[model samples]
Target: MSNEYLYIKVDKNSMAKNKVVYLEDIAKLYSTDTDKINILKKQVVLTIKDNKPIKCVFSILKIIEIIHSIYPDVQVINLGESDFIIQYQPKKERQILKYLKIVMVSLIIFFGSAFAIMTFNEDASVEEVFKKIYELIMGSEKEGGTILEISYSIGIPIGIIVFYNHFSKVKLSNDPTPLKVQMRVYEEELDKTLIANASREDKIIDVD
Candidate 1:
């Protein structure tokens, strides 16, 4: 195939002053022996005598510095064609409310099912199951709805207090303090690596 040539309008000021050299001219200088010269839209190409073709299409300034250091007499001629690389990243949301809703609904369904099973037991009445639950909770073996009546007046508030206290003790670490959970996780990972890499002599051998 016939080699295609691009007529690059050489900058008079750059060549005259010998200040900032354009990269496009570098390719043409090298193309005297080779026909694979291309002038990409935004790039600057540079080639030094007896050296590999230096493709400098992105940063014209950096390319000029490189060329002047190696071949001070050489001027940039043309930039070469290169594949542009790009990457994309996705954002993640820590939706605590969404997670909490799912957990709470699951808990309610599970507990409600247990409640239903207990209430519909062959020997136990709805009143009886509630009475048993109350007795278990209130530390009372009362034979009547005295516990239920008490629970309606006082037990609901007491249950709420108990639940609040338990919830507080759950230690979700929601406070603004910077806990080293990541460090602990790293330590666990290190331990796993150590276990995986341990020599047979270093491992605890189970003697029968």
Candidate 2:
């Protein structure tokens, strides 16, 4: 998946006074980074950082407040951030269920046809008997009296086992869908915050 980078342009003078804010501090304020980002200069030039669309946009507003608080005549413009949303392909549960159904049905058809061939041809070879039975159940031929007897006696039970076995293994062991997406976003946000806090502390230490 593609990630987005949010850019906020502060005044040159403000930036000259400070440097750049940590990316982590911006992420902590915003939940996601899905917005237009950019940087510009008019009165003073500060710094730009990454943040989510909704939160970062709002954060910029607060930033304007902070700028105006100090430099009342400062010119601030929202250069806007860049947004990148990657399209993802995810498998649906229905596809898995449909595949299983086809397999189970195919097995039942095979077993039914075998039973029919065995009933009709008393002298038929084992393979031939199975083939004829397969054709009959597939609606290719009419069922004979012998086929009816074989089906009730054995075919039904075999069908049940085949279906049960196929269905039992339908679920996959490693499915990366819901949880993975959420976790990725969470981890990214956390990492950003940690980096920002560390940078801020470094600046304080330098000042001291």
After superposition, candidate 2 runs with Cα above 4 Å error = 1-24, 27-59, 81-208
Query: What TM-score does prediction 1 earn?
Result: 0.20
Write the residue-wise lDDT of candidate 1 on 71-134 in tens digits. 4554454353111111112223469978988899989977986676666653556566677777
Tens digits of per-residue lDDT for model 2, 1-208: 2342323542211111123443222322221323321121232222433332111112345555554554445454456322211111222358889999999998998998787766755665644565577676775753454555566559666665554443344633345445456887886675455435545554211211
Provide TM-scores for the models: 0.20, 0.18
Candidate models: Cα lDDT each: 0.42, 0.42
Candidate with maximal lDDT: 2
